[model samples]
Target: MDNTVEQVNVLCIKWGDKYGSDYVNTLYSMVSRNLSRPFRFICLTDEAGGIRDEVEVKDIPKIGFKDFDEKHPWAKAHGWLKLTCFANPLYDLQGPTLFLDLDIVIVGSLDKFFEPEGDFLVIKEWDKSDATGNTSVFRFEAGAHEDALDYLKQDANKATADVRNEQEYITQFVDRQNKLKYWPEQWCRSFKRHCLRPFPFSFFQQPRIPEGAKVIIFHGKPHPDDALRGRSGKWYRKVLPTGWIAEYWR
Candidate 1:
């Protein structure tokens, strides 16, 4: 280990029981294998028990979503809590911070993510025609966009009404500042949209990993584990057991 080498931050937030510690541990393991450069794997969570010792665990930041909590208790489930990653002083972590959702599976080298020239980078929503970017895998300098969080804290009611989710809110704010950039289309792929075979073909064939995909975003339904076992999470859609997921998802 060279002390002089610069270490970037790899961050993930785990607030609820929806995902367990195994998800964090597996992500850390995947990152360790694929990222050549030195990095800090940090998990911001409400409960850190059972997480691997190698990961630095920090409590999830509180952005004071009192109004939202009262009116829309469902807001928390909508990823509003992720805005805390933009807090001005994110517990001493700084520079080129990559925020990854717990559900994502890294399959390629992540060194290229920090090489991109942009103040903020995200995955363009494949399903949307608008400028909205998926929040599954996004990068920004730590402490650079506290305003996004402030906007939500100041008026949770108005913020929630304006945007459908946290990703939309952050995307609009960064785009307004002319700092939003998207990764190449092939780098961060949506498993549901890009991998799963369409309709009838999906029933028999296993999902294929897209070429050049560094991170596979399991945004909804049939997460990495579910896909591995051939559980599509829906009756109509069929996902055959994919053995390759075990190759990289560990």
Candidate 2:
């Protein structure tokens, strides 16, 4: 490595009322504990009212959509398209950006993600088992993936209309690029893979955070609160390990 001590920037985006400032604060705390470097904790948000003290807060950079015309998820103002800072560089998004969804916890040191690998690095979807990117957490250079935004700009409504999720369109764009890369196999993982059990075995076993997993992502229903309580978000108790949430939240 040219510089063993890498200067990494951690980025997150928040908009509207669906989620509160607590998500950002918790993320900041978790990241602070996990990553050791000249790190920058940036939150691209509409309003910075309740954000933490150390974070560098900035307004959600302009995409020229005027906020009202953003896509469905972003128009919801909380989905995720708003967090795709690498798209246009409007927010002064710079350097190598590690875009993390706020609903996750940083359980281990994140130095592995900084190892140079690809132009754009994302977690390979565990379920799809293909190039499908699990965008819950990913990294890229700021304003680097302009084509991803160009696709939307060319056909704003159509680009995001058919797909039910934002990551779908973004993944499609990345796959076509031929420059997209993925994280080292073990650094990023799905919570279910390392945490919740699928069935009866779950009763006897706890989720096994992989040997070198850097980030455990709670993609769908089970959130940090749910995971913390040792329960999935569903009504019936599955093979979720008890006290996992207490371990992180405490």
Kindly report which residue stretches of model 1 are placed more than 4 angstroms away from their true locations once superposed: 1-4, 64-72
58 Cα displacement, candidate 2 (Å):
1.3
lDDT of 2 by residue, 43-68 (tens): 98777998889999986655645443
Tell how far residue 9 is off in model 2, in angstroms: 1.2
Using alpha carbons, what is the TM-score of model 1?
Answer: 0.94
Cα TM-score of candidate 2: 0.85
Please list all clashing residue pairs in model 1, or write none if there are none: none
Total backbone collisions, model 2: 3
Q: In lDDT terms, which candidate is top? A: 1
Off by over 4 Å in 2: 1-6, 66-74, 77-80, 236-241
lDDT of each: 0.87, 0.72
